[model samples]
Target: MQTLEGMIAPKFSLKNEVGEIISLDNFAGKKYVVLYFYPKDSTTSCTTEACDFRDSHEAFTALNAVILGVSADDEKAHTKFIKKYGLPFSLLIDDTHEVSEAYGVWRLKKMFGKEFMGIERSTFLIDPTGTVIKEWRKIKVGGHVEEALDTLKKL
Candidate 1:
C-alpha cells in the first residue's frame, strides 16, 4: 500500500458530475479536502462508502474540509448515483483513469478466479497547502468516513 502522508499530493483536473472542472489547485490554500476514490458507483461497497460520507458532509464542511469522490464512471452514472443517494458532495469523473493512475489507485484485481484491472478503494486527506496529511488504501467502508473526519479534526 502506498502511504503519501507528508508528501505533496498528485495534481489532477477532472470534470465533476455536472461537467464542471475540479482540480487540486482549486482547493489549494483554501480548504482541506477529503478526496476519495472508489471502484464504481451504486455498487454495494461503493454506495455504502459514498453514503457514509454523505451522512457526515456537514461535519466535514464545518471543519473547513471539502469532500470529493472520484471514479471511472461518467457524468450520467454519477448523476443517477447522486440523485439516488442524495450525495451532497461532488463526484469527479476519471473515465480515462488518469487521476486514479496518478494516485496509484488504479490496479489489478482478481475475483472468483477472474483477473481484471480496476481501482483500489482509497482516500486521501489533503491539507489547505496541497500536502497529503493522511491516506487510507484499500479502505474498508465501516466507520471510514468518521475516521477521516477524526483525522481532519487534528488538522
Candidate 2:
C-alpha cells in the first residue's frame, strides 16, 4: 500500500457518474475531498460503504468536503450504481486503473483460488491544500464513514 499522508496526490481527470469529466483540479481551491477507492460499484460491501457516505453527505458538505468514489468500472456502470443507490457523491470511472495504481489500491487478490488484479478498498482524506492528510487501506465497511468524519471534523 502507498503511504499518502503528507504527499501530493496524483492528479486525475476521470469521467463521473453523470458522464462529466471531473478532475482533481476541479476541487482545488474549493473543497477538501474524501476520495475513496472501492472494488466495484453496487456490490454488497461497496453499496454499504457508498450508502454510509451518502447518509453523511450533509455533514461532509458542512465541512466543505466532497466525497468521490472511484472504481475500475466505467461511467455507465457508475451512473447506474449511483441511481440505484441514490448515492449523493460523484463516482469516478477509473477504467484504466491509472488512478487506482497511483493510489496503490489496485492489487493482486485470490478468491475461490483464482488470483486476479482487483481494487483494495481504501480511503484518502485530502485537505483543501491538496495534500493527503489521512489514508485507510484494506478498509472495513462498517462505521467507516464515522471514522473518516471524525478525522475531517478535527481538521
* Candidate topping TM-score: 1
> What lDDT does the true structure give each of the candidates?
0.94, 0.91
RMSD of 2: 0.9
Over the stretch 1-155, how does candidate 2's per-residue lDDT look in tens digits? 54989998888899887789998889888899899999988899999999999999999999999999999888788889989989888999898998999999989988999999999999999887789999999999998999999999997
Off by over 4 Å in 2: none
**Index of the highest-lDDT prediction:** 1
TM-score of 2: 0.97
Error of 2 at 80 (Å): 1.3
For every model shown, what is its TM-score relative to the native structure? Answer: 0.98, 0.97
Q: How many clashes (backbone atoms < 3 Å, residues ≥3 apart in a chain or on different chains) does model 1 have?
A: 0
Cα TM-score of candidate 1? 0.98
Off by over 4 Å in 1: none
- What clash pairs does model 2 have? none
